[model samples]
Target: MNNSKKANYSIKCTVENCANHCGKEQYCSLDCICVGTHEGNPTMDQCTDCKSFLLK
Candidate 1:
């Protein structure tokens, strides 16, 4: 069995209030993140938002 851990790169995030936001670094430390929105058939970037967002 492979015991090696997968590599995860930091994602640049500007939302400071998000729980996953790296302090002052503008990056997310989380290995991965989920994104979603309230409406269906989204057409723009604004239509999509972070589903993993957590209040700071």
Candidate 2:
């Protein structure tokens, strides 16, 4: 049996809307962290207006 453990990296959400302070960046199953295309893209400012992110 392989019992290797996976390393996890946590990202703290500075966004006031989100209740969770610290969470996994890429490992978050419930929430997804992706890159933005434009300079004003909300996802780029994860701690500001992530709710306005437009996924393409």
Candidate 3:
């Protein structure tokens, strides 16, 4: 994982374990992120997920 990369301020992230997360910063390193929901009809924040996340 290259934590030296610059943060994409457009996407704020706090999941330090994600490969796309900006090191020590509250932001994502990717230009964009994919968002998805496990539930067919998502009704809560918990139902939504960061589909772009990859294990670091």
**Candidate 1 weakest lDDT stretch, 10 residues:** 1-10
lDDT of 2 by residue, 1-56 (tens): 11232222443343333333222332222245543344454553444544433332
For 1-56, candidate 1 gives per-residue lDDT tens digits of: 11232323457788777766766566776788898887788888999988878887
- Lowest lDDT sum, 10 consecutive residues, model 3, at 1-10
TM-score: the better of candidates 1 and 3: 3
Residues 1-56 of candidate 3 have per-residue lDDT tens digits of: 67688999899999989988888888998988889999999999999999999998
Ranking by TM-score: 3, 1, 2
lDDT value for model 3: 0.91
Kindly indicate the candidate among 1 and 2 with the higher TM-score.
Answer: 1
- Give candidate 1's TM-score: 0.75
- Candidate 3 regions off by >4 Å? none
What C-alpha lDDT, on a 0 to 100 scale, does residue 55 get in candidate 2?
30
Where does the lowest 10-residue lDDT sum fall in candidate 2?
A: 21-30
**TM-scores for all candidates?**
0.75, 0.25, 0.91
